[model samples]
Target chain A: MNKKIKQNIAFFVFRLFSLLIVGVLISILGFIAINGIQVIDWEFLTTAPKEGMTEGGIFPAIVGTFYLVVGSLIFAVPLGVMSAIYTVEYAGNGRIVRFIRMMTNNLASIPSIVFGLFGMALFVNKLGFGDSIIAGSLTLGLLTLPIIIRTSEEALKAVPESYRTGSYALGAGKLQTIRKVILPSAMPNILTGIILSVGRVSGETAPILFTVAAYFLPSLPDSIFSQAMALPYHLYVLATSGTDVEASRPIAYGTALVLIMIVLFFNLLAAFLRQRLNKKLKQH
Target chain B: MIETKNINFYYGDFHAIKNISMKMEPNTVTAFIGPSGCGKSTFLRLFNRMNDLINNTRLEGECLIKSKNIYDKSIDVDELRKDVGMVFQKPNPFPKSIFENVAYGLKVNGVKDKKFIAQKVEESLMAAALWDEVKDKLHKSAFELSGGQQQRLCIARALAVAPSVLLMDEPASALDPISTSKIEELIHQLKSNYTIVIVTHNMQQAARVSDKTGFFMMGELVEYSDTKKMFLNPDKETTQNYITGRFG
Candidate 1:
């Protein structure tokens, strides 16, 4: 075949694959929306389950998932951002830095089921927290920690080198330079890391399965130590293991749609915040 | 006011600056002119120790400013930098407002009196010949200014710390001819208050702005003398060929 014909065929294949993924995503969303939209009244959203997990809304699971997301972020963001600053800024490319980077990469690739088991062994049983929000959050936090660290490191590194040199030339110390110049410049990008972690922590079922998820809870969690009904785990039980699986299928679809919406909400919030920060940096 | 004694610098195993000794008088404009990669900019950075930021770089010999060894173990590098300020090849204004850009040096040095900072910012801007252009929009972003104006803002930022020595590493090389002339004129006016050292690829720029001139070639200072004598009657044949546009 001629080069032009070969190039045309390659381009067509690439376009087909890209559109294929988009088609798959749209079909899944359409399936869930069509099957779930009828069950999504205000009463369905705000009330507890009725008739043995067959009727009513998954309010407690919604709140529980929300709590887990917030808790995980509270646990991971500070630790991850600080670690990234230390590794990317203060730590030169020495043996220790390389070792730390290697360990982080290894941690990122570990299966979420392993994190679930580790959390059960450490937070749930050994530490005696038992299947509670705190334990589950810590587990999910660990799962997302490597992602945050990698992203924050990239964000810090993305800042122009001239800013650091400019600050130092003005006689600013390392800490001051980072706090005043580097951190402000890297804030928008670091927020992207936080956004990504929120999405990951919210949708995860395995890590929370053995740590914090409840099979059936009618009320919202009263404290951090209380067993919580998370959306993903609740959906899993309703769709797969529950006695009234066919009856609760619509509720499970609704729960999946709500989870996706929550993730989308947080992503939109973060994108808005990034825009404001960039504008603030530019205007004043 | 500035002196180096047999300075030798290396980037790993590759020697960048050979043994070179020179003295610059206080309150005079001294220009170092050379081709690219001739170590003129590297030698200029030695005054402020900007090269310390790079890794695996080695320096041998004493760099003294005001008769104090800046490279001594006891010296505080930040403190030394405050006494010697440098402007870079490209204008690097922080992503901040015009007022904040000039106030950065003072704020970093722990000056908290808002009134004093405001006054110093004004004075520094005036000294850099930028106050007339940007006085009305102090709160606007520094990026809003033109390239020439931003370079002057950087100079104003350096002057806010009250350094006695100013170093310019090809400050006008990236600018247009009109802006270059403006920077050259600013350097002439700034000589009485600060010891100025500049590195330029333009030999005519050195002749026009420098009181003393140093010609560097392949990591060596081939000649150092009064600007008129170096350009009019160079001591070395190479310097003569270079100044007369014969050397490649």
Candidate 2:
């Protein structure tokens, strides 16, 4: 009886430790959901900001966020995919490959704020893109570069060497093997990486803040030179300094909740894609 | 036909294949009979320059395919590989449909017609003796097949390119007896069209399939002669001991 009691106590302690972290997260999410759901309205999502408040609706921010995701994908994908090819296909465990790998790992661990500062000096100031969507997106692209490279490298690495040998034995050159066999096999995982980058961008207010100065333009961007409002910055302002604290509270929570939902939708999408691709892969 | 002259290989100063010189005739199946780590597979890979992939690996002397030295700077590896096809120990099919697996080479070389690819895929499958089983499921993934079927698919994939020389590195080592025999029969049928060179540790397999045999031991060619002579009367005591149920 004593031994069983001791065992039960141990199990309870372990359960408590696990629940402590999970419980806190769940409670936070619940609080946000409860507080935010009422603010969700069609007008709030579609309408522009009113007066100087910048808290009325997130239309401009939504547009800006979309631009950010698209622009970053354009810049980061080819570079990441090419680097992954070099690392996984041609590179041995030599000094240069090891160095590139080390740099990639280091890049992933870097703080977003530092990237913001770098963007401020590099794109916003030096290159003269100013507080434009392009500047902010390039910063985000830099931020997501290492992630895509590492994830793609991992996906490429996960491909069996037998596949390459098979291709080569079939008389395929280097590019053909990578283009047809390796790239297609690694696609779903690469998509997951890009999706993860999108999630990373949607949550980033700090990187855009320093890089893209608040322009509050009501019109859509006609060129890369225009400054834009990001969803994260808009959410920050709505939560912090709105006209009616009680009324704006809902909008803040709603935006966050929407962001979370968007992220979750993408995550689930990635999971679905991974599942389907894995099934197809198993058939081969 | 391939002829190696005083060939040697090294992996970072460690000798892998030492002074291997042998001539393989057209339309003849040559079995490389050996124990493990005797550099049989290494020697086989030299014909298509497959060994050029290994880091810090250096080759000395020449490997000639039809009097053209494959190691010369003018030699296009892509073209060399097109002429010399290889099948590995383990069956490796691409993550593609059955038809695509066989038609990969043709597609890469820019054959765009749909009907031609289909015809070639069927012809290769028939040549590899797998058309009857997998004909209906041509659109299915290559990995959906069993190990034996996958190996045959690999063979079909190789044959689609119509290479003159085929190198098989322990082609039946991972297969069951029935599947192995099927492969042997397929090899026999293919001999008239392809110069088949195979490496195998199974003495019975080597004895059964090969017209000419080369027994290798410790990175050296011990004996090369008619399969019957090697089995019935070996030149070396070591060859006799290794082959006649004495030692490997």
Candidate 3:
């Protein structure tokens, strides 16, 4: 075979590999959407599950997941953003900083199930929070902390150094320059990171499983201390350990569909915010 | 008035600027001319302590503005910077509107009176000779302006703070000839109100806009004299060679 023919064959192999991944993703999404669409309805979404988790809606699980997401964001966003700022701006490339960065990367590489176990020991048992919404949110926040910090640091670093210099030349102090220039320029990227974290927090079942997930709770959680049903855990229960797994299959599909839709909504929100911020930043 | 006394600056053991002493009178344009990496820009940055941002930098000497040692422990660097403004080689308007770009210094300094900020923004733009072209679109983005206009806007931003000294690091080297002339004319007009220290590679630009000139070579101030004498009758052979286009 000639060089051109060999090159063409190599290119074809790479194309096939790419298509294989895309094909797998499309097939999974197609299966979920097809099986899940039939079971979704206004009544099913708004009401609590009934008849041994086979007949009613997953309203309480939806509300519980919403609370978990909001709670995790509250703990995670500010802490993540501040950590990123300190790492990127305040901390020089010293030995300590490098060690801290390495630790963060290692935390990111740890398995989600390990985070679940840690959360179980720390928040659920030692902290005496038990299997509650607050514990679960905190666990999820921990699970996603590395992602948020790394992404936010990248975002802050992406802001050009010139903007800081311009602000400093005008007699703005470090804080003033960061607040008035650096933060605004990096806002879009930071939002993207937060959105990604949100997706991760919402879809996670392992961390919450041991820390906060309830086997069967149909009512809305009234406070942080209350046990709540989350979408992922509810889906897991319906598909695996339910009294009648065959009858609960549709509910499981619907729960999966709702979880996917929530993530999609957050992704859309991030894109919209990025576009709006870019426009504002560009405006004279 | 500004003066530096036997200044020696080092960037982490790299001797960037050698022993140099020079004085600049208030309300006059003084220009420093040299080739790249000759430390003309470094010497200019010393006035505002802009070089402090770099790590492992050392300075041995006093930089004085109006008889006050700016590098003294008691001197507030931010206050000193406010009094001495700098414009870079490239136009760096804040990612803000024209009005806000000019008003940034005041806002950062805790100036909150709306009328005062608005008045100062207009005055600075007028001083930079960019008012008429952008007067109607004061709220437009600074990036929308042409290269020349953006540089003028940066100048306007520096002027809005009412600094006693204005430093330009090749402010017009990034512009076309017409824009360069405009900046030169603005500098000439500005000298009545502010002391100006400019660094440029363009010999004609130094001769055109500066009252006094300092020629630097290899991080050393080779000659310092009136612009006319330096260009017409230099005392040093190296200065003569440089000005006559024999070599940089």
Please name the candidate that would achieve the greatest TM-score relative to the true structure. 3
lDDT of 2 by residue, A63-134 (tens): 787788788789999999899889888887889999999999899888999999999999999999888888
Q: Candidate 2: list runs displaced more than 4 Å.
A: A1-6, A51-56, A213-215, A244-246, A282-284
DockQ of 3: 0.82
Where does candidate 2 clash, by residue pair? A284-B143
lDDT of 3: 0.92
Off by over 4 Å in 1: A1-15
Residue-level lDDT tens digits of model 2 in B128-240: 99999999999899888888888999999999988999999999989988889999999999999999999998999999999999988888998999999999999899999
Top candidate on DockQ is 3
lDDT, candidates in the order shown:
0.93, 0.87, 0.92
Ranking by TM-score: 3, 1, 2
Off by over 4 Å in 3: A3-5
Model 1 C-alpha lDDT versus the unseen true structure? 0.93
TM-score of chain B, per candidate? 0.99, 0.98, 0.99
Candidate 3 per-residue lDDT over residues B1-248, each given as its tens digit: 99999999999989989999889998999999987899999999999999999889999988889999999999988998999999999999888899999999999999999999999999999999999999999999998999999999999999998899999999998999999999999999999999999999999999999999999999999999999999999999999988889986
Tens digits of per-residue lDDT for model 3, A37-78: 999999889999999999889999999999999989899888
Task: State the number of backbone clashes in model 3.
Answer: 3
TM-score for each candidate, following the candidate numbering:
0.96, 0.96, 0.98
Q: List the RMSD of every prediction in angstroms.
A: 1.8, 1.9, 1.2
* Chain A TM-score vs. truth, each candidate: 0.96, 0.92, 0.96
Q: A156 in model 3: Cα distance from truth in Å? A: 1.4
